[model samples]
Structure formats: C-alpha cells, structure tokens
Target: MRRLRPVRGKERRKKPIHDGCFEIRNPARLLVVAPRVPCPVKSEHISDAVASVIGPDFTIAFQPIVDLELREVFAHEALVRGLHGEGAYEVLGKVQAHHRFAFHEACRVKSIEMASMLGMRSRLSLNVAPNDIAGPAECFHTAIRTAERVGFPVDRLMFELTEGEPVADLPALAATFRSFQRFGFTSAIDDFGAAYAGFELLAAFQPDVVKLDVSFVRDIHLSAVRFTIVKGFVAICDELRIQVIAEGVEAPEEVDVLRRLGVRLFQGFLFARPGTAVLPEVAWDAA
Candidate 1:
C-alpha cells in the first residue's frame, strides 16, 4: 500500500449548489468520531478470500468532482483500480460471480478506510451493483457498521447505482434506496442517459443526483440534438429538484455547453484525472 501525505487544512462546509442539495464538508481535522468497531461485514477475512479468488491485485482510486461556478472541489468519487494502478476495467474484470459479493463488500470497506486516511471531509461517492444488494438487509447493516468502524458518517456517503449492470427488480432496488435514505445516505443514478431502466428508473425512484452519461456529454457543444436533450434533462431535474453532474467531460467546449444548460457540478479528465490513494486538487479554468 502507498502512504499518502498528511492532508493539510481543515474541512469546511460551503454553500450548496442548490437548495436541498446535500453536499457537505466539515471544517475539522482527522476526527476519530469513534474507535474502530468489529465491522459486521468481516471485510478483512472476505478481502483476503476475494483476493485469492480473484487475483491478489486490486485497489481504489479517487476522482474529484468540481463545482463549476465556485471552481472548487465538491466531492471525490471512489473508483476501483488494479494493484499496479491499472485501469478500472483491468481490476473489475477479475471479479467472478462466486466472489462478486465479497469483492463488493470489501471495496466498500476499503473506500471508507482510504478516504478516512486521506482526511476526506466532503461526501464520498461509492458505486454499488443494484442486483447484488437488491434484497439483503445484512448487506446494508454491514455497510453501516463499516462506516462506523472508520468514523465515516453515513450522511457523508453517497451510493451510486451504476448503469453498467442491469437491475432485474426495480421495486426491490427502490425499496433499498429508500431504506438508505431513511438512514441518512443519499442515492444517485449514475450514467443516466445510457443505462437500463433509464427513464423508468427516474419515474420510479428519484435519486438525489443524476450523472449525465458520457455519450451525451461528448462533443455536445457541436451537436444541437445532444444540446437539446441535455437541456431538457436539466429542466426536468430542476423541476424534480435533483442535482445534476456531467461526467466524462474532457473538452472546454463541452464544459461551456453544460454550464449554460444549468449544470454546476462536473467530473471528468477536464478537471482532474483519477488519483490512486491521493486526493488531487482541482485546477480551475474559466468555465
């Protein structure tokens, strides 16, 4: 494991991009809100098993989310990486059905631990497979215990339902998200425009945040159709009062168009590349 430099400065809570937007940062130092608990997930043992089952080579990375208007970091999304800092696909491809659940649980614990070690004060976004956790109360409980063990507040966690994996049961997923919300955890529909149950999921369950898929954001400034679609999507989110973040943004032109269409939060190479075990600060440019 790579040792990270001690993060300097206190975490501070800033004004939110929109009312009801639950973005928070604490102006405090490394606070062991509580001593480590015996994580109910038994993540340690499971991680060892998972590594053996898959390949003993995997880790986590973080990519910063920027508040375009403020030109500051809003949150850091926890991503999976290979042991050698290879791409996510390389790490994720090693997962098999037999150990997928264990890998998922272990990833959760690792992300929390790494974030806490780095003194991350803002919300930590974690990805989850909706199908794997569709109906497990134990899964949720274990996650809560894991956070408590690391002193990471449940309120500062955002669970993103990835679009890559298609969910079989919408009702079950919605119920799970509701349960998380009840426990002070926020939900997000990631890869919004390109996923299964795209519009249907929105109608059934309104996530606190919606990340526009890369397909829509790619070369958007040059395409009137993409612009129109994104603009309409932004309008609907505004009415529904859901925050939107444009992901995979790589060009200045794309950022310009997205900002004009009421998008204030963005995540992509344009702001900062994903960092392994390190929190990369945002290099602001006029947006």
Candidate 2:
C-alpha cells in the first residue's frame, strides 16, 4: 500500500466564473449574509435573494495594508456584509447569539462571490478559521477554483487565518498549509500578537505574512512598552523578509511611531475605512 503525496496537483473540473478561466458553477455555502438585503449580485446561491445593497458603482474598496513608508496596501481583506441590512459585525453578535451558524456559511459564500467579482490587482483577504482549513479540502479547493474562474489571482489573495482552534496534529496542519500554498494561495497569521503561537507559527508554518493585532496598534503613542514589543517583532520580520502588515492604524502619531520603529505595512481606520476605495485621498507617504 502506498500513501498519497498529500495532494497530487490534479486538474479537477472547473466551473469557470470569468472568461474561459473563471468559473463558479458550484459556489461555496455561505451561512450569514441574509439575502433579504439588497446585494449587488445575482447567482443561484440561495433559493431567493432580496435586492443588492451595493449601488451601481460595482466597486469594492481595498485599503492598503502597507509598510510604514505609507505605501498603498494592495492586499484588501475580504469583508462580510449583509446587503442593505446593518454591518456584518453587528449582525455577527445576533447570529452567534441566535446560533444561526447554518445561515453564516451561505452569507460567507455570497460575500466571496461579490468580492471576487470586484477584485482588481489586489489580494482579497478572506477570514477563515483554522478549522476551515482542516475541514473538507473540497471547500478550499472550491474557493481557489472559484477565484480562478472570477479572474482573481489566487496567489495574490491572502487567507487571513485568525488564531485559535488548536492544531490536533502538527503534521496534518503542515500538510494543509502546503496544499493551499501549492494552489498559489498564501496564508497569513492574523492577529499575530494575540495568538500564543508567535514564533512557533513563524518557525512551523512560515506564513507569507503576519498581521500585528490591532490592540497594540490602538494606543501605540502613549505606550513605549508597545513600541518595544512591536519593535522586536519587526526586527525578526525584517530578518526573515516576511512583510509585516500592522492592522488598526488610526492616528498619525501611531503611524509615525510604527514608521520610526522600522515596522512597515499598516491597515486601519486612519488610512481608509473598510469598504471605501482601495487608496483614499489621504496624503500618506511611505517615506
């Protein structure tokens, strides 16, 4: 008996969504976004969807997740929305409280389709549980295939893997990471400081990118301790050459500190609000 090489890189059937390459014949199952709200999309996803909240603009903004130099962040995190209803975060509490986990998947799938359709030259950062990665490989494969069909670069797209959910087996985890990598999709360890993995994930998984949790970024100026803490990570990241994208950027003072400290890459309300244009009119400089 022989074991598989994890994944044998096979050309499975594709439901191209764009041109001859993009397809989404079988989209993923989203469980949160309510179709009752107006969504600027049309698909065979749910039995019936209301209208699209997105206007005729057909634009999904990508706030730059950039270095301290103030460069534009090309990697836009895929945000979840509930069409014309309230924002996703508010609805999150409601859904979680009501235990509407089933609807959540349906919502997520719709969001992905909308974002992918609007993607252009930037990576759409989609939040995913570590469990999702370990779950049925078919789903993830579907995501990659869908991206290809939608004319989005799978390699450029970063799956923002939030911390939590213990890895039952280290080997299995590594194998999964490799599978996504092989598909040209990169993984990011979101909220790096919040997780205990810290250096462990860096050494084990060697993620392509690491997002500095927003907590440290919030009150960075008044706290020198935060500077020391973030500086240390920046030093290691510089050595590894792995880009450090700081989330939750708000104040010019905080950006000043992060820039001086040698930590590059930032994303937060200061730069541009989520759902706004990718690069705002703000005169932020990478220098």
Q: Which lDDT values do the candidates have, in the order given?
A: 0.71, 0.55
Best-matching candidate per lDDT: 1
Prediction 2 global C-alpha lDDT: 0.55
After superposing candidate 1, which stretches have Cα over 4 Å from the reference? 1-48
Model 2 alpha-carbon drift over 4 Å, by segment = 1-63, 67-70, 84-87, 94-108, 164-170, 195-197, 276-287
Please provide TM-scores, in order, for all candidate models, with all chains considered together.
0.81, 0.69
Error (Å) of candidate 2 at residue 126 is 1.1
User: lDDT value for candidate 1?
Assistant: 0.71
Q: What lDDT tens digits, residue by residue, belong to model 2 across residues 73-129?
A: 445565554445346555455444233433334444544566555533445677665
lDDT of 2 at 30: 21
